[model samples]
Target: MEITGNKFALIGLGDFGAHLAMVLSEKGAEVLAIDQNMDNLEEVKDSVAHTVCLDATEEKALMSQGIDEYDAVIVCIGDEFEETLLVVTVLQSLGVKRIIARATTPRHAQILRHLQIKEVILPAVDAADRLANKLLFQSKLSSLELSSDYEIIEVDAPDKFVGKNLRELELRVHYDVSLITIKRIELKPRLLGGTREVEHIIGIPSPDTVIERGDVLMLFGKKESVQRMMAD
Candidate 1:
């Protein structure tokens, strides 16, 4: 995760931006933090490589600080759309390699897209989607989208499939699906400087491993085939 020798600038020093700066710093990036508010700048002083209390829209001042040297710039001014747009345009004009922006609304996102901003983040919307999924699909077990028409899902092993090896199960012949992995809970000792044990299943499980109750069997197939397998 080291970002050594890579320069990154972040505009806005609010909660979202501050958190991102801390993470990037921890990952070994040379982070330059910017905010108009002195208090916000002070808050992240210890986490970043440098902090500047200046408006990002000041193109000359920003350039003086060598904004062009940065590998990427993240515009995180969530409240002021105009300021965000200004900063984005300035960054683009300065030839920054990549620009990522945060938008608070769909209309703002549309505006950024029209301006040719390559990346836009709607944190609130993404958080809502994750929360809703957790609530409604508490028993989802595991799910992954392979393509528009295909998916892979792992669910708690049903009673009928207990003690059956994957070969005996004949998943492809009978259900037109493939067993991709077997997930089971096992306690492992905590690592050095770690406080808790980890529970994870090994991947690419052996063929003779028998399915058991509470075991999560990951399977892959076309959407229709997966749906039929789960229905049984």
Candidate 2:
């Protein structure tokens, strides 16, 4: 998605932060990548809008870079919890528009929450969860957690769902799950001759929309509700 003109500051150019910087830049956001290590700075310097090697915990150094002016500042110092917390606190004191911090553990997350940081990311834990989901659910293509209770998952349509219209399925009433959209495969002719399959989303499906074979359903609901729907 294009996020042109949006500005973001990422403090700590660890693996997660570096990757995030590249992604944000690719999406057309202006990203400032920061880290104390020159090596880390060098890695993302060409990708992001700017790269600076400076200790984030130092308020003066951060202020000099206008950290508070950005749309958001993400603290990604994963190795050192103390340093992460300190940097977050400094960002808070600087009156940053938004602050997101990375927590290495549950306890670390709790501490960040106590510090009144609204957004905390546990990248390792999230990655593990996603991997577990992929391993456990054969039909599921991907899943995104919106919160502890809710998730949006993409799954191959079950046998019973094919040829059935949404109204006939009564997904919301019976399954307690919402089908956000449907992805269908269509064949497009290639320049040489034969056709190639391309997956396209049929946006905002209606009650009469029928599910075709090989359709991928994007469903959103409580984890248990979604699991029940898929199971049945």
Candidate 3:
């Protein structure tokens, strides 16, 4: 869960493994990247704490490198079932504490699950879900995922909400959303009498603050409620 120690071994330095290694390292984790391919190892050598050209399926070789002592081991040789299975089997035999694996197909996921691998990632499916969410909330200025069920989105106030105030909407009571902030643009007369649009930020608006048209709201709530509010 925490990726900041020198306690992770990332095997099969493919795209996923390499990127993960770099990210963990960037977050202050000392990552050891292993790959049978010299080119793969070379590409990520300088980025990680260590890079090993290793045939990880060999139990003796894997253990010799002390990979079993790591807090977690990640297997990314998913396309090569035999190699991946052997690597995981060796990790188990060595009593590695935690294992994360990538699943190339449904069958691969099932097989890994049968091995009692607790965390399995299906990259394509994960990517597709992310793309779908991007499309679903594309109209929003931005969307931040706080958890699987909660999100914060900055969206244009719904048309029906124009001229309505926070108390009148009863957002929390009705929609389970909190109007955190409102960015308002209004025309104000200058000292010379000519009016110019001045920007005003309403921070944590009171119950009676009216929601004028052209207001951008930062709303926080459950994903379902936010989605429903945006749609309705």
Candidate 4:
């Protein structure tokens, strides 16, 4: 996976933080890895564009690094709930455009959401591939709304999802969702640039249709249930 040019600042160089930094860097985004501990910074230094050891709780120190200039900042402060909240609040005050934080518990996730951080993640549960896939297929709104209670969004097949046939996944039986369509995308080489080519497999999919990792699923379900499925 490669993004031509994007920049990210990842705070807290713990296991998940380190992995996230490495993946984003490999995907061609410039990553700035930060942590108070020099050891953590050193561990990921080779994988990222820059690594800094500084106390994120100190607004002056963090601001000195020009953190707000990054495209997005990720708060990966694990275990220190209050400390995480403090850092997040300071970032919010700085008016960061996007803050993706890791919440250790559901309550923490709720608080992050309350702070208007749309991308609060569960720590320890997210793998590098899963996170990357989420970033890849997380949908942007189209000029459409299906209904008040249901809608359609394109999502990547979950990383752990084996190429399961539609019947085996039991999306409808268990989640009360409908598979609307499947879209396959490829890049078409052009003289000056790359053009996206989309091929659609729309309809009541045959039971034999199996889900693949990069395949995009167009699904319709109750809003809450669809969100749960997507979050999973």
Off by over 4 Å in 3: 1-6, 140-232
TM-score per model over all chains: 0.59, 0.61, 0.61, 0.56
CA-RMSD of model 3: 17.8
The residue pairs found clashing in candidate 2 are none
* lDDT of candidates 1 onward, in order: 0.78, 0.82, 0.79, 0.76
**Residues 26-106 of candidate 4: C-alpha lDDT, one tens digit per residue:** 989999998999988888898899998889988888899888898888999899989888999889888787788888876
Which digits, one per residue and each the tens of the lDDT, describe model 1 over residues 31-136? 9999999999999999999999887998887998899888878898989999999999998889987888888987787788788875677777656644664555
lDDT of 3 by residue, 1-232 (tens): 2233466999998888888889888878878999999999888888899988878988888988998778789998857887888888889999998898887876787777789886776777656644764465464434444767666767788889998888889989888988888877665543322233444567779999998877888788887888887787
Q: Which candidate do you rate higher for lDDT, 1 or 3?
A: 3
Candidate 4: lDDT over CA atoms? 0.76
Best by lDDT: 2
Show pairs that collide, candidate 4. none
* lDDT, candidate 4, at 115: 76
lDDT of 2 by residue, 1-232 (tens): 1122489999988898999999999988999999999999999999999988888989999999999889888888878999998898889899997888888877788788788876777777656644664475544444443777787877899998999999999999998999999877676553333233455668999999999988889888887887888898
